[model samples]
Target: MIKKSELNRMADVANDRGVTVWVEFEGRRYGVTPPAATPPLDDTEESDLDRELEAFKAKNGYR
Candidate 1:
């Protein structure tokens, strides 16, 4: 886990710039963004997209 102080500093910069902060750990990268910088998705639209993705995955034989 990242240190709290470092994470706080990164969050401050990201919030100020309206962008996301990326960190790498254990060979993987993660992003943290302020909620205000992200747009909310409509539930209906999200469900429709999920259904479409499931259908595509099934058609492609992805388990």
Candidate 2:
């Protein structure tokens, strides 16, 4: 079995490069890839969502 520290290092490398990382164990090869970067929400859309959230929070009496 691979050590926890080694697995963490592999994950770090994959995230830094935004590429797939693979490892072999027993007779099988396993791989992991970082998720694609999501585009930022438009300013107007974000503001509208924020307003909606605030309204919901107020209605629910959440601070």
Candidate 3:
């Protein structure tokens, strides 16, 4: 069971790197783009994820 604080920390690191972070919890997968969401512990960010997420947020703003 992962703690919410730990998740928040991981999100912060991913945000700093301008990457997305995906997390699979409770048998569900969640893909979070930096500034809004971060990728899981996949060991690497998806190609163009930063660009893609940022553009999406710019267009729609973070919900």
TM-score of each: 0.51, 0.64, 0.42
For TM-score, candidate 1 versus 2, the one ahead is 2
Per-residue alpha-carbon lDDT of candidate 2 for residues 1-63, written as tens digits (9 for 90 to 100): 988887888889899998899999999987878878999989999999999999999999999
lDDT of 3 by residue, 31-54 (tens): 656764554755345656877888
Tell me the deviation in Å of residue 59 in model 2.
13
**Global CA lDDT computed for model 3:** 0.75
lDDT of 3 at 38: 50
Which lDDT values do the candidates have, in the order given? Answer: 0.88, 0.91, 0.75
Worst 10 residues of 2 by lDDT: 27-36
Q: Any runs in candidate 1 off by more than 4 Å, and if so which? A: 37-63
| Superior by lDDT: candidate 1 or candidate 3 | 1
Instruction: Give candidate 2 misplaced runs (Cα > 4 Å).
Output: 47-63
Instruction: Write down the TM-score for model 1.
Output: 0.51
Question: How close to the true structure is residue 19 of candidate 3, measured as C-alpha lDDT?
Answer: 81
Predicted structure 2: lDDT: 0.91
Error of 3 at 41 (Å): 35
